[model samples]
Target: MRIQFMLNGSSETVDAEADTRLINVLRERYHLIGTHASCYSGECGSCIVLINGEIFHSCMTPLFRVRGMRVTTIEGFAKQHAYKEVLAGFREAGLSPCRFCAAGRILTTHALLEISPNPGEEEIAEYYRAVKCRCTDFRTYLKAVQYTGRLRRNRHRVS
Candidate 1:
């Protein structure tokens, strides 16, 4: 199938099979390897991507299903947060995922921040649940979210 859509922030077209998983297509064909696939199923959020501005597990999403939609991967959304800020937050919290899980974790946090710039504990749990994290428990990740929110808020107030 010939799929056309907005990737990141630009129009993109790629040839894909009807049943081809979006994760494979993105990583292999499109070469957007930043959208990692660990579980090869929706159970792991490693293959998560922003489909039409909402996070979706790409491993379960067929390319044909997202033909006309916009898909944003980690590289795109991660840029929303300063690289140093994310790295420092991860280091300070003593919770960094292995390279395989980093992309999804980063993007998940980015999406949560986009929705709730200052989410509370419950809200953070709800968002983190969707990612199905394997490295860090919700507690450490929650701290990162809180830190991210504070950073964003502080930046906003300063601006």
Candidate 2:
């Protein structure tokens, strides 16, 4: 079947099977490798992608589900202003996630901040739970979120 959707900021159409996972189409068909396929069961969160402003585990999500919807992988999210600011904040806060979990965490953070720009520590913790990062402590990631919030506020204040 042919599915059409908005990818990043452009429209995309591809032929895929009924049971094909979104991650497969993304990585294999479109070559959008930023959305990794870790646990096919969706427990790893490594395959997380934003679909219509919400995070979905692409590994478990069917391609037909995203048909006509907007899907944003880490590659697409990287071009966003929020991504840029959050990344800078991560660096400034000395928060470094391993490559395996970084993209998923970033996407989760972006979704959280987009929904709640001034989220409290509890909220940050709650959202961070979506991404499993066994190698790093959550403190640095939380600090980065706080810093990004501040940066966003400052930018809005000047504009």
- The candidate scoring highest on lDDT is 2
Q: How accurate is candidate 1 locally (lDDT)?
A: 0.79
- Model 2 off-target regions past 4 Å? none
Q: Pick the candidate with the highest TM-score.
A: 2
Question: In order, what lDDT does every prediction score?
Answer: 0.79, 0.88
**Candidate 1, superposed: residue stretches over 4 Å from native:** 81-84
lDDT of 2 at 68: 90
The C-alpha TM-scores of every prediction are: 0.86, 0.95
Question: How close is each model in CA RMSD to the real structure?
Answer: 2.1, 1.1
**Backbone clashes, each candidate:** 0, 0
| Native-to-model Cα distance after best TM-score fit, residue 91 in candidate 2, in Å | 1.1
Candidate 1: deviation at residue 130, Å? 2.6
- TM-score result, candidate 1: 0.86
- The ten-residue window of minimal lDDT in model 1 covers 78-87
